[model samples]
Target chain A: MSLISQEVPAFDTRVPAYLQRLERAMDALLPPAGTDPDRLHQAMRYACDGGKHLRALMVYATGETLGVAPECLDPAACAVELIHAYSLVHDDLPGMDNDDLRRGRPTVHKAFDIATAILVGDALQTLAFEALANAGAIDAEQKVRMIRSLAHASGSLGMVGGQAVDMASENLTLNIGQLESLHARKTGALILVTCQLAGIAARAPEQVRHALDRYGRCIGLAFQIQDDVLDQIADTATLGKTAGKDQVQNKSTFPSLLGLEQAQHRANALFDEARDAARSISGDAEPLLWLADHIQQRDH
Target chain B: MSLISQEVPAFDTRVPAYLQRLERAMDALLPPAGTDPDRLHQAMRYACDGGKHLRALMVYATGETLGVAPECLDPAACAVELIHAYSLVHDDLPGMDNDDLRRGRPTVHKAFDIATAILVGDALQTLAFEALANAGAIDAEQKVRMIRSLAHASGSLGMVGGQAVDMASENLTLNIGQLESLHARKTGALILVTCQLAGIAARAPEQVRHALDRYGRCIGLAFQIQDDVLDQIADTATLGKTAGKDQVQNKSTFPSLLGLEQAQHRANALFDEARDAARSISGDAEPLLWLADHIQQRDH
Candidate 1:
């Protein structure tokens, strides 16, 4: 069965437009082809070519909820997506996951040489911070805070640290608690940062920020659990990646430990929690609420 | 003849004190060795373990010349050194330069696994910007500029981009101009940023900033030429790295394009220009002047 065939919830009418805006903003932000070091630039664009843009959506959704203008949120959207793309490129490298495919296309290291892929990932990571620093909409103080937040979430104590743990635990059996911590850092940190960045952008009040944090945490875990469920039930074509990769690599996942039915239930519970968190903020949080449902119901 | 046996310049009386301060600061700034993801953090510290710290010294010297206190400059100094260390770790990976020895010891990948080394480099790069963002001395505006400057210098258009070009140019003969451009981006960009950062910290006048820039450019080129010369003359033990790896990899160096004698003479000339640039500034530029001489005279 196709994973996309699952019953998906209706998204906000503004989502398609937001996605288009994000694509355009990202294209404009990246160095154009035929630039010097054309090969590296080309590879970077390739790595970022296609994705669901869920993270970018979160940024826009949170910003809109906090009453920030869409244009003002563009840089954060682009920056988070760039960071996501770079992480995928590195994660798919031969020395890492040794994956040959990503997003239904040959991985960067597969299309280009390993060296070019490495450089592409490194350069893309650098550009993420560059984008945030150059973001003119925010004041200098906000830019500094944004940079610090992104860096803290992306560094050894966050995504990279989680990756190190993930790599180390490839063959070892991890308990449910350990797995949660792993995915929290490996995938949740970046997602959570998207919300924090929006808060920074809108100068969100303390209560709003706290509510957004809760919403982010709930949805972040829900997103990962859904991923684990999809990996188990979906085929490679449906997932657009190497399905069952976690199982094949003997990496313990949510479904692996909790069983497929329980994992799905867990995701649904998290979605409810995420919705409640968003409700705590008395404003236009419709998009964030819609994304929580989308994350739970969407196949891939 | 051993490169270290050559007549080296006498050091400044404060050089040792500065080095000690830098070492302590870097140690404190980095995560403790016992931190989680112990292996990756260990590799990061290992890569940063020991070096001449010429880059950090440049930051301190320039800031001091511009009347910025040493304590105020510590973050920039540490940040640049971390970036330098991360670059070296990545460059020494099996897929890139394939180097096994660095700083008279096994490279990060050699001591740890390839995967761990890659994570170490990625995490360390992230931490560099984090350090700059969290730097307490500078105001938010200065911090943003510093982050942007460092990111621009370290990105594809700068260090990473130059590395990509260098890898592509391997086994292909490059003229002196090509080599200069390559080294300017690869090695010189970070060095130049050290001085630029000092200017940013001090909020130096336009003229002082321009002179410091010229000084940085001259010293950057001179430093690379001296590296090329030392690579040709020094053995593995004296150079503290695989001295002839460039030749073995069929890579071109300054002495390869220009004759050894011409390379040495060119370095001396650049050193003179750098000294003059420092003298143009209206302050006690003694440290900058001494560094110029040191670049020309030092073997490694």
Candidate 2:
């Protein structure tokens, strides 16, 4: 059940380069720290400055798999990352998860004031849609579809809705089905939309869209299960966030409902299903396959 | 300087009908109150339920002025109202304005919980964009434009930025120009976008769009100035929100900077400019003109 007991996949040589590109793009997209309302602009940049860039990677990977160029994927990539960052900023607020740290840095509310943190999150969420709308490489129709997809994924019925349920369900026992449903919205929705955005960017046919969506769903669930597992076995320094908080808060996690061994097995099965979905598309899928392995095997 | 001293424009029979239509559209667009995650959904509906709905009215009036059908304007109307609602929700939070009452009802945070209120604001903002994207009458291009406009208006450089400045400037004196700049972002941005959305919906010519933008700018500023004037003079029962909160918080306002009499004069001047801008368009501008008069004359 230990994370070290699981086999580690070899590092993909391309990930670092992709992450570097994404970081630069995001920096360019965000307002400079010196801008008027400097505190907010600074917080916005700080909240998004560092992360694993996994969501951006998913966007790029899916786009590459569908033969869409990386340049065309940058907006979707940056947009998804912004959404992820905003969620973290909100989730770490004093009224929410109340975490002091995120990605090894002081959370936005700690660094700035609570009001600034809330505004930072709000501004970042707005910037996500703005980034997509102005993604010039994508056509109007594609922009609309991407906006709809991202908004739907991030809204009440999607990521926010999931968080609501998660908050409400604290200290209450839930079956595996309920847990899966919660994670599907809380985390899976945004991840799923990253893939869906790539499909929109590529102007993929209906069949390819279906395949990509299926792949996204599987990987999304697998990723969360891995997160729950990591929270159990990983330390704060390794995870770069507060680990074991779920248990401390009496929240029912994957490891709480299913034993660590079964959760690990379930994550592995989802990873396999994700890879199969990617492979079903009749084209190069190296990036997606590597991502599947990376999600399952990453230690932190 | 008294609000009652201003001449009330002839009652526009269309205003009530438009409000009725907007209410119906918003109800249909929002998730049912009984849906799963019932509290958040219920909060979202509550946040948006009743107000003067001035922003939605602006959208309808502008669309009507441009000869766009009312049905085509419903999505834009709903979108603006949702954004307005979301801003109010966040503005009323304990860390923000700390208002306990809004539109004669307990604020979302007081009615529900702080976390739920935060999520409700976020979800409503997301729903605004989603609604615009799914607006059946508009073409994809228009939807993209509307999304971009709304996002830009609602984001840092627009409403949120305005809020940050407003918060930071507490207990500080701001000159007239600085006060205008603050209100321009905080309250003016969304109002401006309502007109722009209508322009896009009508497929208005470039000249008409420019004229509408100018008209929107004048009216947006006028509306905020009136709000400030009202806060100083109107009672809480009539305002349906806390009166004199700005003064209590030491936040700068039009009346604070310009004096009540001068602020009223400025609002009237802006109303006149707005009517002129609307009249400059080569069409019957009755609705827009009526809206301009209504904004300055409204007691609350």
- Tens digits of per-residue lDDT, candidate 2, B175-212, equal 88898999899999989999999999999999999999
Runs in model 2 with CA error above 4 Å? A1-11, B1-11
Error of model 2, residue A234, in angstroms: 0.9
How close is each model in CA RMSD to the real structure?
Answer: 6.3, 6.1
Q: B233 in model 1: Cα distance from truth in Å?
A: 1.0
Predicted complex 1: CAPRI docking category: medium
Identify the candidate with maximal DockQ: 2
lDDT of each: 0.89, 0.90
Q: Write the per-residue lDDT of candidate 1 for residues B234-258, one digit (tens) a residue.
A: 9889989988777888889988988
Best by lDDT: 2
Task: Tell me what fraction of the real C-alpha contacts between chains A and B each candidate also makes.
Answer: 0.83, 0.82
